[model samples]
Target: MKYIFATFLLLNTFHLFGQESAPINHELSFQFDNDLLFFDAGDRYYTNGLFFTYRQKIKEDRSWSNLFGFQSLHKSIFHVAFVSKIFNPYNLKGEKAEEIDRPYAGELYVDGLYTSYWGQNRLAVGVDLGWLGTKTRSDDIQTNLHTTFGWVRPRGWRDYQIHDTPIAHLYTGLSREIVSIGPLSLISDVDVRVGTINTNAAAAITMRLGRSQPLDASVLTHARTGERIANDRKCKELFFVTKTQLMHVFYDATIEGNIIGEPSPFVKSAEPWVWMQSVGVMLSMKTFDLQALWSFLGREVVGGRPHKYGTLVIAKRF
Candidate 1:
């Protein structure tokens, strides 16, 4: 498994390293992808996931656009991040106790934006909504877990390895370009979400290195605090990208990752914090765009044996 993951990363890195100069603009785009991963058996299984995305602008202010996407994770095994020993069996029913497989589920969402309404200063808002294809098992497992972690858990919910449950979300956030100091341009992506039968807020900033082949870096912070519709927690995300164009050859590479709070029953015990990371490169020629991405997701650490996952994704847009 380790070798396979290493090889996938190397292959994707080489593929993306070759394509560094690509320009993004106003146009309608559609993308579809399938991703697969294998975990140890007797306690684990593999996942076959699929995704589809569409994005376009309502008009051409070069400032307004919208995105709609769907993602499905089928035949996948979820990890158990926490352990509960003192909870009531009735309360623990249908909770995150061990790893389990879900056949398939769909996620649908849409986001819209309106930038620079008046002049130099700009603003944008976004929203997302979707449902997991299945629902939790209504049994003793759920009740038992809930009783044990009712206080320590971020949300008043137990960690559960759930399947076929609905997953829906909504987000509204804004951003502004505050400074342009020489070769550096600073921008922000901030938003608030009210869904999951709760509410949460998140924000991130981007600092562009104008002279360095249009490279840019960013950091994001998200939290769920108070009783206003979200939970109470905090996390950080980092991102960086660079692109170079030499006549007909163009290449670009981007890396992004996040340290997020894990509230799900599956990962309740391993640690309240988890990490998700991805790196990608794209090469373009005229109207053709070719790209490859390597991603790592799941708990940041697991006892003496850390659990890590990786994927190689290829995509094209025109």
Candidate 2:
């Protein structure tokens, strides 16, 4: 952990500096997450994730755009992504399914998002469609990953895995800048979700320092990226960011199993509220954008402990 943090500092220090807001015509990104990146962090709940996204500035005339708040924007981007998430019990050494601390679950889905920018605010809404349980193929993916990396293979997935079921969910969030001074800014956000997979509401605040841009024209906010028109020339960004969010979780199917279907062999009641923290750095140069962040999540299960994970993202704009 110290080494990683040191390396991040060195990279940021190397610039001591660096450097957003014509909308990129199109953008593509790949992001992945794993707890192993955080040294000494255990392999447990919310263990790994994989995502691929493609985004484009909204250009076509759509009748419902106004109905969905897409037409009220100074600018808007529409994106679609394929995402997968893997979860495991706290202890993989359990001899029996009943001995595990949390349920073993996997989620595979595709989601589409519509985000709009206006003044100091951004609004986003999206829907997810996919499957839960063994159908997500997470056990095989994890087993192969562990074997290839020479790590401990998971135990008893067949015995304790969540049952397969279809998933549908809708979510929306709004973000606004609370304060900004040169290279520093504070932002607030509120988000809500309701669906078969998860039902929750959350609030978060993010602080960033270093090279900065207007909230509507910032890469950190994911409002703009790639070759954006900044001073009518090339644009660059390098910043350190930290965020904290609290969620009121009403239902989590991954841990509680499909509420509308047959129950899994082992399921635990989800905690009512959860906390999450993210600390990282983002750098965007010309056509490429890169980010590295670590996420700490409060326990989702009643008796479970918190967990930490790392995420890496690479994006391209055209």
Candidate maximizing lDDT: 2
**All candidates: TM-score:** 0.38, 0.87
- Tens-place lDDT per residue, model 1, 1-318, is 355335434443422222224322222222222232323211111112223332221332222122211122111111111111111111212233332221111223343333222222223344444333122222233334335755222121323332233333454545455666765666555555554422444444545443311111111111100001112122111123222111110110000111122223232222223333444443322222233444444432233122322333222222
Off by over 4 Å in 1: 1-49, 60-124, 135-166, 173-192, 197-272, 297-318
lDDT (Cα, tens digit) per residue for candidate 2, span 1-318: 355444434443332113344445777777779887787446788888888888877664755434455434566777899998999988877758567878888999999998878778888889999999987788898888788887778886888888888889998999999999988999999999999879999999999899877766677767564234444234477899999999999999888878766778777889999999999998876555789999999988988898889998877666
Query: Model 2 reaches what TM-score against the true structure?
Result: 0.87
RMSD (CA, Å), each prediction: 17.5, 5.7
In order, how many clashes per candidate? 49, 2
Worst 10 residues of 1 by lDDT: 249-258
lDDT to native, each model: 0.28, 0.80
Best by TM-score: 2
lDDT of 2: 0.80
At residue 210, candidate 1 shows an lDDT of 31
